[model samples]
Target: MKNIYELVTMFHDVHPFVPSLSQFAECVVAYIGVFVIKSVFKHLVCLECLESLYSYLTDIRNYSLIARKSNDGLLFPAKDVI
Candidate 1:
């Protein structure tokens, strides 16, 4: 019983520091986890955006190919449809 009391007292003496350190560790871990998730999501979204952009550009190129040159000296590609 005496040993248990001393152990409890010792733990009580360090109570403030224990919780503070635990909270700090948790925040650090959570920040890192959030950063990792954000990076992965950004990468995934960028890939999809790139594919859409390529498709749009290809469509414009096809339009330019079919458009006839006007009587004026300079005939520019048709305006972007989308």
Candidate 2:
């Protein structure tokens, strides 16, 4: 929390408008996470398609895991259209 505050203060001049302090921390953390993800994706030309495929496969695996937890059909759906 303190680190977020320090970062926001340190980088305040970068943005034209300031968000309210209540939303500042959440916004900054989300912005940073997105920035990092974008930076990672930038290195690979076909990353977006691969990432989507990976995410869909993970969802299917998760569904199978859930189904195996019990005999009952808990029917977790796959992300078919990513």
TM-score of every prediction relative to native: 0.26, 0.26
Per-model C-alpha lDDT, please? 0.39, 0.44
lDDT of 1 at 19: 40
Query: For residues 1-82, what per-residue lDDT tens digits would candidate 2 score against the true structure?
Result: 5788888887885767855554445434433433444555567678555365223232433343443453652222324321
Consecutive 10-residue window with the lowest summed lDDT within model 1: 73-82
What shift in Å separates residue 15 of candidate 2 from its native position after superposition?
A: 36
- Tens digits of per-residue lDDT, candidate 1, 8-78, equal 98888884743444544543443343344444455666665434322222233333322223233222221
Off by over 4 Å in 1: 1-21, 45-82
Clashing pairs in 2: none
Task: Predict model 2's lDDT versus the native.
Answer: 0.44
